[model samples]
Target: MSQSLDRALTLLGSLGDGPVSLGQAAASIGVHKSTALRLLRTLEEHGFVHRLSDRRYRLGGRVLSLAQRALQGIDVRQVAAPYLAALHERFGCTVQLAVLEDDEVLYLDELTGRWSTGAGLPDRIGRRAPAAGTAIGRVLLAGLPQDGRAEEELPAELAAVRRRGWAAESSGHLETVTSVAAPVAGSDRRAVAACAVSAPADRVSPAELVRLVPELLCTAEAISLAYGGSPTPRWCENRCGARPVVRASRT
Candidate 1:
């Protein structure tokens, strides 16, 4: 593997246990402290890693987002594209693929409604969102590992999503947008990402959002299976889908 890829996996493996000091991380990864710091810094810039107030490092919010996009740009999205487009056409709304990084939700890819201003929003392929208010955020938050102190409220609805299989939001994150999301798992049987749909609150209801759960779950699972993830994840899953599509392929 390339040096960067090797370092990233090392960082990820180290983070699976809990937050650690830079020194510990360097030692665990068998790299010089300076080299580890440089790698961490690079990962931080891409949203794949985070640095705590104490200078400890953790996973960042962009990791999931980028991973999902990477998967979509590969084979899973290509396979799911028709399904995603069909869903968008049926609902005339926006469909989003989201993944967890740190304590946030990151957009992987989206299919927007004809009348939607989704393109105007900052939710490009790698845009990040607070994993609190939005339905996608709730879905991701619900799937996050309980390894470290979250430092955020774990709402009942979000908790319910973990118990159940989905979550919804009604004009919570945005002023008038309603959303529904479902968890996606990784090979470790953990929730790593989610798939969601969003529409104008005026045009969608809580019941309707709940009804969309199965479809979102299907999409998420398809992506997860593509990534060789398990049928069930312990926390969250990575929906890379089975195929690896690079951004260059999209371009």
Candidate 2:
């Protein structure tokens, strides 16, 4: 790589130790303090670094925004498409794939199942819902680390979801609807999205929906693995033990 590019990347990596002063960065990277300041200024102009009031430099919001956009383009929905269709075929319940976006569950894809009510559960693709209320939300939230928000700010149902490793809701977002969801994790074992099945409450009563937990969990694992998620002990027992196996991404 060019010297400037190499130096910039070296400086970026150095900031991982937290904010650094020009002298500290120069000494660490084997560059003069003046050269380090010039590089830092270039990075600041691009919003890749921020100079603090104390004259230390740290990462900037632009870097965070870029990382978020990269995560959003991970193609989990594409990776899970066939599995979702198979899940829909098995139970004939609406199958949905969603990701948590700014405290809301943003529906990325949906497959209408055979048992769809055709009334209560509308086509949810391109739609969003509060993350504290829906089954998918609970599953996604359960996978996240606890942030010390007030208990009242979070729904009590999340506790049950964490304990059960899954979540289900009756009349969720729509009257007479029942929805069950499981987390779809990434390579880091962090839930990047959720897989959910929705049907009319009368047709797929909560008790009957409970019976589908195994299948839902299995499908989620299959999708998670396809997306490069590290396999858990349960997943190791029989990795992706589901039908219509999804092909893992080569990338």
Worst 10 residues of 1 by lDDT: 242-251
- In model 1, where do residues sit more than 4 Å from their true spots? 1-83, 117-123, 148-155, 232-251
What's model 2's lDDT at 155?
A: 57
The lDDT of each candidate is 0.69, 0.80
Report the C-alpha lDDT of model 2 over 24-87, residue by residue, as the tens digit. 9898779899999999999999999999999999988888787557645758877888899988
Q: Give the TM-score comparing model 1 with the true structure, all chains together.
A: 0.55
Clashes of each: 19, 0
Per-residue lDDT tens digits of candidate 1, residues 1-251? 99778877978877856788889989988888998898888888887788999899887877667666676664444544655676677777688776777777767678875546543333446567778867777777777776764535556676687777787777654867777887666667677667788876666676787676666666666656555566453222343232322112222
Cand. 2 Cα-lDDT: 0.80
